[model samples]
Target chain A: MRLVISFIAGLVFSAGLVVSGMANPAKVVNFLDFSGSWDPSLAFVMIGAIAVASIGFRLVGENSKPFSAPRFDLPNRKDIDRPLISGAIFFGVGWGLSGYCPGPALVSLVLSSQAMLSLFPMMLLGMWIAKKTA
Target chain B: METLFTPWHSLFGGILIGSAAVLMLWGCGQILGVSGLLSRLLPPWSSSQDIKVRVAFVAGVIALPLLAMVSGQVSSIPPVNGNPLYLGLAGLVMGYGTVRGNGCTSGHGVCGISRLSQRSIVATLVFMATAAVTVYIARHLLGWI
Candidate 1:
């Protein structure tokens, strides 16, 4: 049951990515290109997502455990440190350069294009390096 | 003021994303953090049980786009612009950064902020500000992307 729900959730999330034009690297690049032909569409996507998620979090707070799981497995870290900032900087630069974040990059894999071929492997390598170092 | 404002699609898409997050939270007791999930799938990171669910979720992500293409709901999958070398480099950096930061846009920006987490708020701001600065440098100054 949990797996089925998660699959459905992932499916819906991908659909949302496509429908919102986020799956398009061009659209994302335009959104980030504030000095150029800026596209504010992605902002609406963020706003709409946050708003609904806020309500969802509230409802989830009332429950001790999730519907199928034993307990909620949410992040609990509260410290502000170098890894946090530096990591964000790296992510930002990458996002600005390629306009593809983790989600979109993974979703784009279905296309099996040359770009994804290069990007995805490097991404995995990056993650592996980070894990090894940490 | 409306040069490229896709208000409806963005909002509807966002709502769908939020709905998915909520479903994940309620149904599976997970946060639906993509980078985290991906990282866990690598080597000896997470348990088999956890990996099973993660695989299922990832399958869903991959399968949906293929389905959309088949049904003609989505015409073309957009490719990354600029040099492929730089694009690949960017992916490498982003992969490391997301893992180091412990979250990405969806995890911190959407799920974290929704829960009013201070860490998430700070992380989101940092990334957004950095992204803006990076864009300024890359697009405006360097003009290499």
Candidate 2:
């Protein structure tokens, strides 16, 4: 049942990505492109996502058990750590460069995007390195 | 690059994405962070892990788009900045950043901010500012794109 729910959620999430034009690299990069044809639609994506998720999250109690799972697995890190800042910097640079984040990058795979295909192996390597160093 | 300013469609899609996150949290008691999911799915598998759930979620993410494409709902796949070398570099940095940052656009930007997580909000701001600056450098200063 959990797996089924997860699968369905993934589908819904990807559906949103596709519908929002977020699955398009050009659209994403254009949003970042301030001096050259800037599109602020992605901002709406952020706002819309937050509004619904915030309301939904209100249902979960801080110490309450989940409906089907043992316990909530949310992050517990409280401080603004070094890794977070450095990582965001790197991720932002990458995002600005290619407009491919983890979610949309994976979604683009259904289309067999040549760019994503090429980047996949290297991305794995980077992740592996991060794990080792961490 | 062409700009797609479809606010309504973007909002609708975001709602769907948020609903998906809420579903995962409600059902599985997990934060739906795509990078975190991928990190677990890849190497050095842990003995006690919900590997199946991760696989199922990722499978669904891939499946819907494929189904849509097969059914002609999506007419075409837009080219994602055709330079493989550049994309490879960006992907490498992004992968590292996500794992290091402990979240991605979906995980940190959407779920974190909604939950009022300080780290997530700061991370989101940092990335947004950096991304905007990077774009400025690339499009305005460098004129690469």
Candidate 3:
């Protein structure tokens, strides 16, 4: 049941990504290009997502556990550390350079372009290295 | 302005994303954090149940667009014409950063802020500012992008 719900959620999320033009690298780049031809569409997407989720989080907070699971596995860490800042900086630079975050990058795997081919494998490698080092 | 501002589509899509996050939270008792899901695929980071859920989620993400294409809901996949080397490098760095930082835009920007998490708020700001600065340097100053 939990897996089914997760699958459905993932499907909906991916559809949203496509419909919102987030799967489009050009649109993402334009959104980040504040100095140049700026597109604020993605900002609305973020706002809309956050607003809706905020309500959901509040509602869910009332329950001791979710419908199908034993516990809620939300992040509890609050400290701001070097790893957090440096990691965010690295992630930001990467995002600005490619305009492909994890979700969109995975979604683009079906395209089988040279860029996706190279990017995906390297991304996996990077994750693997991080896992090993950490 | 006309070409860039897609208010309706973005808003609708965002609603869909939020609904998904809600479903994951309410039904599955999990935060809909894509990077965390992907990272769980690695050994030592996931249990059997975690792998199952992650796989299911990834399958859904991969299958939706393909289904849409078959149904003609989507005309075509977008072209990714960036320099392959740079893009690959960016992916590598992003992968590492996401693991180290413990979240991505979806995790920190969406779910984190919605929950009013202090760490997430700070992380989102740092990443957004970094992204803006990086874009300024790469696109405007260096003209590489």
Considering every candidate listed, which one attains the maximal TM-score? 2
* lDDT measured at residue A116 in model 2 versus the true structure, 0 to 100: 73
- At residue A86, candidate 2 shows an lDDT of 98
Cα lDDT, model 2, residue A71: 84
| lDDT of candidate model 3 versus the reference | 0.83
Tens digits of per-residue lDDT for model 1 on A1-134?
88899899899998888788788877787788788878989998999999999999889889999998877888888888888888888888888788788888878887535678788989988888888887
Local distance difference test, each candidate: 0.83, 0.86, 0.83
Misplaced by over 4 Å in model 2 are none
lDDT of 2 by residue, B1-145 (tens): 6775899999999999899999999988989899999898877888777999999999999999899988988855655457788878988998999899999999999999999999999999999899889888877798766
DockQ of each: 0.69, 0.80, 0.70
Each candidate's number of clashing pairs is 0, 0, 0
- At residue B90, give the lDDT of candidate 3: 88
Question: Which candidate model has the greater TM-score, 1 or 3?
Answer: 1
Which stretches of model 3 miss by more than 4 angstroms? A111-113, B1-3, B77-81
* Candidate 1 collision pairs: none
Clashing pairs in 2: none
